[model samples]
Target chain A: MGAAGIGGGTVNLYSWLSQFFGDPDRRHGPDSIVHRVGEHLLFSGEALGWALLLAVPLGLLLGYTGKAAGLVTALSGAARALPTLGLVTLAVLLAGVGDTAVLVPLVALAAPVLLVAACEGVRSTDPDLRDAARGIGLTHRQVLWQVCIPWALPALLAGLRTAAVQVIATATVASYVGLGGLGSYVVGGLATRDFAQTIGGALLVVLLAVATQLLFALLIRYALPAGLRRARD
Target chain B: MIRFDGAAKRHPDGTLAVEGLDLTVPAGRTTVLVGPSGCGKTTILRMVNRMVEPTAGRVLLDGTDVAQLDAAKLRRGIGYVIQQAGLFPHRRVIDNVATVPYLLGWDRKRARTRASELLELVGLPPETARRYPFQLSGGQQQRVGVARALAADPPLLLMDEPFSAVDPVVRSGLQDELLRLQAELNKTVLFVTHDIEEAVRLGDQIVVLREHGRIAQVADPATLLAAPADEQVAAFLGRDRGLRGLALRPAEGIVLLAANTPLDGWTLAVDQEGRPTGWQRSAETIRQVAVFRPGLDTLRTALDSAVLSPARVAVAVDHAGRVIGLAPRAAVLDALDAAGPDTAAGITATGVADGR
Candidate 1:
């Protein structure tokens, strides 16, 4: 289903670009593809920056304190269940249609993934290790920061990777609110019945997913402890 | 010196973990609290460091009420070791050993340096200090736990069944190490154990607790084994108190051997001066007699000599006498059999003189 969606979206994307270049003559050019790719890149970068800045502290707080956890979980679950279009509309209503519309919902979607991951990670740490820390006379805060946080790093990072990929894939929905991403070409192509533009946009999304996954894999490989890596392996 | 005065611990649900208890752990000596499970031996141990507070009365350390001390600060000043070592898996052995020192605000380098020294003191090589707790075996981990407790050189040490988690062989080794450490350091120690044999072996003073946390009796190991305060204490010490008491008795003063006796198997030959010269075999009996001195043989040695000798008699002799008493195989058997299945009051002080 995902492969076919990407193919259809990519075809529509190419056809929509051909019209903008004023080419009734059926010919392919790199310029249109390049321009769309650049737009996709710019949109992803902004979305990623917002996702990280908002998600990290929220994740840390939810992970460490465990207070107000049920409320945070419920709100995150509700946000996640909402349709992408509904979120964009809500964001547009709240902040007016633009980048903020896209940014707000993207952060909302990513925060919960990160927060839940961080909380579970901290909770799952060995109780024996915690007791040992207390036995050794570490303060509660010292135990949290020095022992629990570092121990939970691998799980927290895995959550961040999930949030990053989800944000990239969902960034296409931002186009419906007129934020102008690779999704713009798909939406415009669908309106004008342009197969190439849709196919091209869908292809860009697939490539973005694969590339982001590989990048995060490399990051996790370098970042996680050998013991955690072996455990997962 | 540590004293428990009317100390009682009542849990939230009204279960009395420890009842009104009065005891003193003498300075520079080991006092072992031993009892069956649920007898509150461990609870009593934790109260000394304020890990478990007494609901009534107070625990005093050197005459100062423990409740008045800052819990963390007080704990830092007292060494506490629990069963299973309770070592931090993430920490290297040295860092674990240095825990108390680190808590007391010693510089990292100095604490670590002291930790390395303690590792050696506990008979672990310096290389072991770099490894994590999980990397070590159970025995090694317990040793590290002990080393960690001693790092701050605290005048008081509390151990809660520290060797109970290890196998018997390892437990014996650890017990010996503890004795050696105590001999050199002379720190006031309160050690808790469920094993009566362990209590007999390690305790200079043994405090036996009955069910519901009441003190059954408190006395030196020999006295406790000899004269249990009641049937409860006697039963806790087990039916083999005599054999156990033999283990506690030193070979020095108890055994008596003949002077100018015929050379025999497993016999210690001594000079007229009553110093040991050599051991003789029964098969190689000689016309000349050899004096065997006291203070050099144990009940086990005397038994071995009686068994291997053709005459079937081992003599007990002092410096002046040719032989004070003859320990025939039947006589040794009679003494052991006479001690059978009963708590013999005053047995510890009766037979053997206190030796240096």
Candidate 2:
């Protein structure tokens, strides 16, 4: 299908759709569409896990203490402006092609979004509520836990959803660093001049991003306390 | 009693919010600190709960230094209500009211039971417990704020203009509610406000403050109005302070005339239920009938009723709101004279003002 379709001077879009739903020939193997989707998720999940581990606490600490607000804003702005693809290429050049190289850029892309959301989530709680929390006999630690954290959760989750979608869409770059993901279909198809594989892989990334968004929407809707849910809108 | 013994707060930027001050807030009574904005009355209120640590001297609560006590622990034992209510929007009304009880480590059922009682105490209906703070009206939110503050049954309450946010009608209702609550609880309350009318209405002892939390005058509501310490205080007390003083005294001890006592020209008309309908002067009838309850209403209301009546007689009502008797304008003035101590003190206060 690779050379035959390309050399014959015609690209079949229907062929890509069939392969996207399921690859009948390589059904259960690592080379199959299912395996590639799994790889894409793992790559995104690992990067997000590391981003959350590093960013959430730091963001909350900065927000709680209300220190280094300017620094967080500047850092997030700089991170948002950064080119994820360029960073991925640079990491691959510096450390050689591997999962570590792909993960670094994806984490860089996700962490800033998370840090800002967490920081803003805590920071955005009503000042009156904070004052009441302290005045009503809550210790500083208790105030953060019982009031600030709960108040910030929905905003933090929204940030998580955004970061997740961004990371999942971007993890398709992992294939360029010789990591197995949905991006492999796009990269391998282009080298072999297979348009169907390239288009199918791009469609898969969109599907993953959409699914991640829905999952977070559900999380935010059901996980928050009823009072908080009412307060937000 | 909460005593401020040369207590002071000088901000790091060198602004003196309150100078070295000595004041005693007597227990089981409301002592209000009132002044204009930036007068540091709020700063002074915060001292009792250790919310604002004095830069110099000390604040003693019942003779124990509040500074020496743990801040959170000290605060938990003091009830606090602020202007905006400051209720936690994330919590249900019951949980918000239950805050201090929960903080004191009471179990869920016990804390909630106490919360239910407090909600009722604050005049909130039982169904209000499950609603969120956002769902309630501004006045209802303030009630919840008061209920939350009283949850642990704290002996001291620090209220910073707690009723100021609501409209005048609501503010009056809340003021009446506070009066009722204070009568029952008698907590050692330290209230702060910019409004002198509110101070006069609620304070057992009003401490009028000038710039930098310096005392302008400290006296009961009647005396504060009747005899302000100086022109600055007189101006601060406003023009109709003598009339305002009438509000502080009740309409009791006023001699009521028989309902059948006919004046020179005007005759009182009554409904079948014995309620006053209007004043009839020959063929002409005045429909706007003003009445006061002698057992319940203040002298200000009684005088207002008499002045507003076309017959120049205040219709006195019973507990059932039926017309019980009539009081002439002369009788209300005589009752004002019989509230002798306030008038005598007021004259003495003027003498002191002139002497100064």
Candidate with the greatest lDDT versus the true structure: 2
User: What is candidate 2's CA lDDT for residue A16?
Assistant: 60
Q: lDDT (CA) for every model shown? A: 0.73, 0.87
Q: Total clashes, candidate 1? A: 35
TM-score of each: 0.75, 0.94
Two-chain DockQ for model 1: 0.22
Cα lDDT tens digits, model 1, B1-356, are 98889999999999999988888788888988899999999889988887788999899999999999877677777777888777765567888898888778899999999999999999998899888776788999999999988999999898989999999999999999999999999998999999999998898888888876787787777777777878878888898786566554433433233444553335656567654444467565333333234455444555655665555675666656445644556665555555444443324432111211
Give the least accurate 10-residue stretch of model 2 chain B, judged by summed lDDT. B347-356
The DockQ leader among the candidates is 2
Q: For chain B alone, what TM-score does every candidate structure achieve against the true structure? A: 0.78, 0.94
Docking quality of model 1: it rates as: incorrect
lDDT of 1 by residue, A67-163 (tens): 7677766777887896777888998889897888887777777877877777777776677556545655566777787677766788888887888
Give the per-residue lDDT digits (tens) of candidate 2, residues A73-136: 8999999988988998899889888888998999999999999988988988788888877888
Cα lDDT tens digits for candidate 2, B1-356: 98889999999999999998788888898888899999999999988887898999899999999888999998899999998898887889999999998999999999999999999999999999999998999999999999999999999999988988999999999999999999999998899999999998888888989998898887877788877889999999898888988887788888898887888788888889988888887898888788889868888999999999877888899877788888999999998887685543322322111121
Interface RMSDs of all predictions? 3.3, 1.0
